[model samples]
Target: MAEAQREKVIRKIEQHLRKTSRQLIKIDTEEQALQYLSDSFRAKLYCDFVGVVFVEDDLFVPKTWSGNVNEVRDTFPLRVDHCSKQLLEHSLTDKEVGLAVDECQLFSLLKKAGVKTWFTVPIKDELHTFGFCMIGFLSYVPLLEMGKHFDEFGQDVAVAISMTRNREMQLKKIEGIEWITKNLSIDAPFEESIEEITTRAGKGTNAEFACIYLYNDYDNCFIYQPPSYGEMKAPKQVRIEHNYILKEHFPFLEKTGGNQMTIPISMDLKTIGVLHVERKRSGVFMDEDLQILRLLSNHIATILENARLYNNEKENRNRLHFLLEYQQALVKETVKHEGFDGIISMLGELFNESVVLFDRFMRPLTYTMDREEEVLIPQLRAEAEKARRKVNPHIVLTEYSQTFSIWPINSGGDLLGYLAVRMSGNELNDYDQIMIEMARNICSIQFIKQKLVLDATEQAKENFISKLLVENVENHESILQYANLFMWDLYNPHRVALLSITLRENELEGCNLLEQQAKKAVVWDYIKVFAVEKTKEILAAMFKEQYLFIVPAEKGVQEFWPQFYKDIQEAGKRSGIHCDILLGVGGKTDNLHDYYASSEQARQALNIVQSRFKEKGYAFFEELGSYTILHQIDNEKTTDLFLENQLGPLEKYSQGKNMDLIHTLRVYLQNNGNAKSTAEELFIHRSSLLYRLEKIESLLESDLSDAEVRFNLLMAFKLYDMRGKMS
Candidate 1:
């Protein structure tokens, strides 16, 4: 009968062991494992009180308990020093069966809680003892009365508990291996793997909440909330410097909150963010549970890292493909399509961003924004300019969450403009830069091709005109026919002003050198429209190096002349050539032959200005008063006189080393007669500058308020600038 009972007990223990093992396998987190152990032990062990106490330092702290367990767990402190020396010694000696029942502090507590018999088992893994599991029976049965049955029951329970733990450890190892294999595969997205990690963690541990907070280096914050969670209940973002989560917040775990067990998730010594798990039930964690969480954490980290790399690689490939296609399309297309609009639309579709292309001046050329009108085009332009000037190319506009890139277009060393693209979405990477360069190359080629075609057509027309005029054999009707052709080709409304510059005889070493230089420097297409409907000598080149060119009057040749002179001077300086310019404005004329007389008068006027202003570097017809008065003004003498009269006192004071006086005068002038403003400007106490000013007024024996006195001082300040004596 006893044998049958023993067999039945063995059968029951085995069944319970299997059930507990299954429960442990379902445990996703440490908290769930604790709860499972507590519940399972209480119901199966037939104990009035069941509790698990984790060893902290040298003391066993109650982590999970049941049936008024909180009362004892809270008040009773189980120190290893105060407990059974026999049991403690046995735990140290025996690696497997660290179970002991003795009269100790825990036993005393059980006695007080109306417990008669108790069994204590050390929950351990391969290495060290993690904690002790206690099962207390309230009955006061004598030791001899139930010795045989007690021994059998106690041994069975210990074996079952140990088996359950072994299974949990084994399962955790399997799960870790499986997760690593699956996550390391190239098919997984980073976010998907992270989600799987967190989800599996939550389910396996039976945690109420499980989250992996990733470190955001850009924001220097933690992103704990997943996208599916519909935004974090916490602020949209939290700074790491302000609200750092520490291990102390988790009371169920040891120092650093199970950090040792969670080393894998913590990333092998680089734990920037936390992987947190919580339970609704109190004391829902065990050392074994922590171990599982730690293992799982490692898998989570690996998966997250892999996923991030995959995402970056994927984005790079996509960007490259988009750029290749866009560039190919640009090269193939010839018509002047909607410049950046089509490009922006294509980029938007390809890169998943609202793109805007701006000109070199920052004006928006084309955009793909939802609210184009609301977009701050000017501000965006300013930002792009500022970024180009002050920051590196890799910088992103964090305030607006936008990125900027610039590309310049040039044809034959002449800058046409720049292409500026503003994109929104992920920050631009190296791949984005490569793609932008590709697009820029395509745009540059197209711009150059179009410019070449236009230049070639204009040159052909110019050549035809030169050939006809040189033959000197065309009749009036033939010349008129060519003029009519020129008028039709140069479509804009135009007027003519003939300019003739007489080169000194033999002064230029090379014949036709000036004309050759002019041909290379001046844009012919721009000049042709200038001579529309004027004279047959629209662009006349005489053998004496005296050239007469008719330019458009209404096309603002007046404004162009100043810049033209500057360009000519620069070109002349570079080529070691010098020539005088004689500009004569002919009245606006519509007929080609009628302006010949006006052109003659302009030539004569240019000669008069050149002869009269022989010593001057530049002589403008408008600057010559009455078109004849050219008086020489000695600028050096004038500068000297002005400096001696106006800046004499300041120079004398500076020579005398009266720095206080010099500073006071400067402040007074800057302040515009306001004592307070002077003091503020000098960063001195108001009384100090005022006192200095009063002393100067007293010493000079002059009323500073007097108009004449102030005027003299102002002139002195002005003269300081002329004399270069301000410093």
Candidate 2:
């Protein structure tokens, strides 16, 4: 009976070992292996408690338990006493060694739970100790007999756990390599690919955080890329000194009891980026984990470098194609001779932006823009002029959040106009700059071409104006024929207006005749263009220092002349020039032969304005009744003699002194020798006027109450004023 019972126990032990081995073989994880070992021990040995205690640091951690002691699983990992740890270490040094339950904290928990007998066997191989397999029984048990079987079972459980872990690690490595290979392509966005790589890296190594940082060559810093799987506590930018992870790089590791690793993503020994992973310090990383990370890093480096080269080539090809297409479109448009407006519209369409063409005066000559962009045209013109003053093409940012790139249309050394583009939400790349430069060159050519035709037309008009002003015409057929060429109605009643511009001392103070003529030529061109644009039917020409225009004698044209004066003054202020502009209008004439008479009258009126030093602005020839006669006299000595005979004494007295006496005499005569009206007009009391009159009478040796003497003095005052203007 004793031999049969022993054989039954041996068969059951073999059956339990075989059952556990089959379950562990099918198991895919470490937790299943541990749980099966605990269940098998409890059922086969009829033990009340079965627990797996794994050594972690200096504590015994109960990983899994079965039977009645499941309630005490959380009670450990308990801090074992020093002697207990020494006993465990010594017992675990050999495969057959057993630990005394009294000295172990794990068994103490089972002892307190009313376990009567308990034993522990080290779950170890020939080379290393894993942990211990502990068993407890509520009733008395034969420990000497079960101790051998417990040790053998512990060995089997250890092998199962190690094999399961190795298998999982190998699977993880294979998955990592497969993921890297599958995602290696330039079709995906660079950021998306990097994010997938980081996520796979984190999962493969079982890391808490994973991140990839790329090196920015311009900023000279490593910019962190967020992972798709988890959040990172690392900073967004880091300045790395080398291609490895330093212990001091992460202070969170020390505080949170974590470990981190990093590997460089490099090309040709130059590190372009780094891959990082971190985990809580429960277990150290294995060689397999590092191997997976290194593989990912190398693959990431290759992808980055290949993507860069591929994208660069693709970009070059696309840019070249874009430029070629633009050139072809422009050439096709040019063949049609579509003018400046057509070119501006084409640019607007090609760039999908607002475009404006401005003349040298910063006036918007043509534009292709929406309503919102039209509202910004004035601002764009202002900025373009500001940039032109800088003498170069550049970018401008306005307060309204608009960006404009202004390119000067320069012919030779002269800036003819500007071509501006509104770049609202994009940066101008190199290809865009090249296209803009090409457009500017095209615009310059177009401007020169137009200027040539305009110059020829202007020369024809200049010849007609010169002959009409100075030549006497006997036959009206020739004059009519010449006027009809410019679509002018020579039979219409028209007025001749002469506009003369004189720069102030600051502009022409030290300039020679050639420099002054050059400046005047620019001003004359501006005036002629302005006149033609303002009134399409007006015939204008620049002759010497004067601008001549034949405008229809209508109410609208009369109103336009005043505004024209204001416009010229505003232009002078804008151009940083202080100038005096005098415009004189002659009488209307219907006959082409009487046009010369109007020109003479206009010239005479202009001469009157020049005679008055303080006078500027427009004057009509009909308004200057006697001044025209005086200016036409053309005898300076006779006027001087008349002034000497009439008020020569007053003139001598006025020298180096106030002209109060002379002014008093002139006022007295203008009031028809009336004292009260003269005093009122002079804003002086009658007695003070009489006192000046008495002094003037004494100096001039004349009688104040004589009408003939007052008349002579009046003519002298008129000549005197005109003489001052001449001087």
Candidate 3:
């Protein structure tokens, strides 16, 4: 009879084992497995209530249940709190399965569920308690005998749940990989890939939100990328100053009152960015979510790598094509047009962007933009210029995405003005940067080409201006035609001003063509009113280390020569021209004949001013008045003969006695023979000056206080001081 009872027990055990295996095989999902276990436990053990609860992020979620499944999952407020965790520990360690309602933290909740007694067995292996299956009864329940099958049933349940979870995770990872592969294209833009990556991550992990914050070493901060999932938005790029604490700056987290999770997206252990997620509950994120996110992150890194490589290769090919086309365009421009205007037009046409060329000194040489943009573009360029000084990249721009990338045009160590491409977007990808850089190279080459042509043009202008000054105008039409070609209104009423510039002796050591051009540019700026392009009246040309400007005279101008001369002197002082600068002006004229006449007059004036020994300043022919007769002589021979004959006696006395007898005689005669004034004029005492005058009188053999003698002595001193330079 005992053996028959034992065999009955063994058969029941075998049947239970076979049923557990069959249930696990039929149920390929964790939820289904949990549901079958709960129902089986209820039927075999005749329990009134049975349920399976899994711990997901500290919440005892009702995965499946035989009784009250809907209420337990939807509204039943029960979780693995600290007290429940303690109870679970006791159940695992002390092998305690049943707990009276008063002794359990879940007493209130269970009472609400209409259960009088409850028993729990931890569904765990050696690693962790994934959850627990709980059984309860409203009537008398057998507790001692129930322990017999409870342990084995719980162990079987744990293994099934573990396998189901692992299988689900594997399936989830596979779906995630497939989703990423399907959504991402290798040749897609980096921004598109970034947007899709964050979206997929959020979906795969079941996160409420997900966004990327790529760290920029240049800005030393993470730049927030807006999630493309909803209406949320962010700056095109923001330089985050805070560490990982972007709460204050990140606007997306402003209304999100929940636990935040930040997973660093890494490639080869180097963190490139971070993925952000949030949940309303503090511990809603589970380990399974982390696993999913980690897998998604791996795929993201690979997608990023593939996208970059594909885009780089495509960009390289496109850039090579653009470069070849750009060089061909440059060659066309060079052969057709030799000025910067053509090159500027070509750049503007190719890029469909504004092109501004500036000298190294920041002076704009040429520009091509819209009428409305003319003012705005320069200001935008100014800001970009500042950024470039800090971060000298091929493409420079602002965070607001107002303008496109600003490229510093450089070639062979020479920096031309920057080339700014007016892209509609904020970031510069490899293709855009390469295109801009290629444009820069083209600009550099054109700049060099334009400079060479300009130099030759300037030399031709100098020759024409020189010829116009001295050559006889036999054919007024020819001269006028030539002047018209140079945009010079020679027929208009104008005057000639010749300027002779001499550099300071100290700065002469390092002087070269560049230095000369620089100095001339500075001086030209100083005399803007007299520069050819600055004023309709002023037309200047460089010739033989000097400048000859033909200034037009209009009605009521009142002879600009005085102001022009004064400006030249001021310019010398401002330019720090320690050496002397001389300017001579001629009277106004209205025809080529008079213009040539004025040019000759200006040349004579320039010669006289430069040849002076005692007087050095501007000499205007109109202001010269009656002194014009003194400059009409062919050479110094006639003036020399007159001055020698007039002062020969005083000159002989001064040489023999080593005294300035002629000067004494001239001073005495000019001061009306007043000894006191003459002595004062010479800064000497009256008595000593009187003795010199007496000696001068002895040498000259002239009567004292004779008006004719005084007149002749005055004339001689004037010629003597003129030093054969009265012309």
Q: TM-score for each prediction?
A: 0.49, 0.58, 0.54
Which portions of model 3 miss their true places by more than 4 Å?
Answer: 1-122, 125-127, 130-183, 188-285, 297-499, 502-616, 620-675, 682-727
- Provide the lDDT at 398 for model 1: 58
User: CA lDDT of 199 in candidate 1?
Assistant: 66
Worst 10 residues of 2 by lDDT: 88-97
lDDT scores of the candidates, listed in order = 0.54, 0.73, 0.65
Clashing pairs in 2: 611-725
Q: Rank by TM-score, descending?
A: 2, 3, 1
Q: Candidate 2: which stretches are off by over 4 Å?
A: 1-284, 287-321, 324-338, 371-415, 418-420, 425-441, 474-482, 502-532, 554-580, 590-592, 609-616, 628-665, 674-705, 716-727
Higher-scoring candidate on TM-score, 1 or 3: 3
Q: How many backbone clashes does candidate 3 have?
A: 1
Task: Please give the lDDT score for candidate 1.
Answer: 0.54
Candidate 2 lDDT over residue span 230-288, tens digit each: 77787888765654453355443213223767777889989788787887336544555
Q: Which prediction has more favorable lDDT, 1 or 2?
A: 2
Candidate with best lDDT: 2
* TM-score-better candidate, 2 vs 3: 2
